[model samples]
Target chain A: MEKIPILRMGDFLLVTIQVDMHDRLAMALQDDLTQKISETSARGVLIDISSLEIVDSFIGRMLGNIAAMSRVLDAQTVVVGMRPAVAITLVELGMSLPGVRTALNVDAGMELLRESLNGHEGIRHGSNF
Target chain B: MAVISSETIPVTSEPDIVFVRRRVRETAAQIGLSLVDQTKVVTAASELARNTLIYGGGGAMQLESLNGPRLGVRLTFSDNGPGIPDIQLALRDGFTTGSGLGLGLGGTKRLVNEFAIESKVGQGTKIIITRWK
Candidate 1:
């Protein structure tokens, strides 16, 4: 019944994960994010997880899946505000999250998303020329 | 050493896994584990709890506070579902029989100070892990 809010910022979707997410909620988020990307024609996604203290393999996989799905939907994803402990535990859990970009905070994440989107636009323009 | 306190919580669904991780974090912190250690134990608990629900067909986790020369928290997950046919293979990374990425058992083992698992074809499986402070 509880749902995570997905905020739209320009061409990007911002998700700030403040609660300890259950498995179903995580899966729902993945589905919602991909749908949002398609519906809004968003070019980027930013996931803020500074408030999340623990990230197991399941959540880690969800994050990875969101990134991969976003890529296919013509969007780039940047995860921000990962706690040091969570980062260490995730790596030890053997989830490198290869497809997901990460930043130290929301500001940096937004910047990364902007750069990624702009870079893609540049490539698109270059191809036309 | 003796257990200072203990409690058992059922893991029948997805939300229960989140509850197990929260309880494990609180127990580990209560035992004065460092931030990193608490995170490690809680992360391990999350993975194992999911395994119980998904693979073992639901079970329970017993959380215990240990007292001795070293203070610590111990968690035991028991299930009576269809048992793992090959624990050695199951413990190997990337060897999942399901749709999972197959990091649960092997990665959980690395996050704790002590880990033990036992299973039989029809008898189900039990895993006990401990982290010392």
Candidate 2:
């Protein structure tokens, strides 16, 4: 598998994991995100987990941690491009990531990030919209 | 700020873990929380479930959903297994008493909007975490 890559995109930091599943990558991703969130104080973060095929408990928690860290930094975080298969595992494993925002694709996720930065009030509403 | 709703689920072991995670997400989704919010809630549930299995000696998970304007999910995993003797030690990263990578409590704490932990030597452990939607 390709190594996970972290990139800075404007106001949002994008972290891409090449791993097929959520594994110890959760911890590694957490560390990388925390450092970026702390140093730049970016208003938003987009974790591109599109490459991931599965999400286990550990990776789910790690994603959750990124959201929490972003909150602490006064920045918002969004998880973009998760495969449906991964979502199924997450649901099956009984892991809920309530604090993080997820978008079907990077564009949608980026749009949400912009909305968050624009001070949109209703963004906190559930995922159906 | 206050707990809105709480429920206790008793089941065999791993199977029940999935139930709690789904229920919390469903409730959060019903409240209009975003996908990101659902992920946080579910991730927190997974942590608690794993702990319940590994440390709690297979007991039950107490799930709390806080609503009204700002929504949040609070969950507690209580097991009569071997209690965590040192709360601080257990909270540290890379400190797993089990086969896990040791991200159970610490990672769960990071996943929620609000977090609290309590445990006794022989009794059990109670982890209270709230993730706002």
Docking class of 1: medium
Instruction: List clash counts for every candidate, in order.
Output: 0, 25
How many Å off is the CA of A31 in candidate 1? 0.6
Residue A37 of model 2 has an lDDT of 77
- What TM-score quantifies how close candidate 1 is to the native fold? 0.96
For candidate 2 chain B, which ten residues in a row score worst on lDDT?
B98-107
Q: lDDT of each structure?
A: 0.89, 0.70
Candidate 1 chain B lowest-lDDT run of ten: B95-104
TM-score of every candidate relative to the true structure: 0.96, 0.52
TM-score of chain A of each: 0.93, 0.82
Model 2: per-residue Cα lDDT over B1-133, one tens digit each: 6666778887346557657766877777776666766765676676677677766778787776676557766677677877888888877754676475345356556656787877888887777776676
Best by TM-score: 1
Each candidate: fraction of true contacts kept? 0.79, 0.02
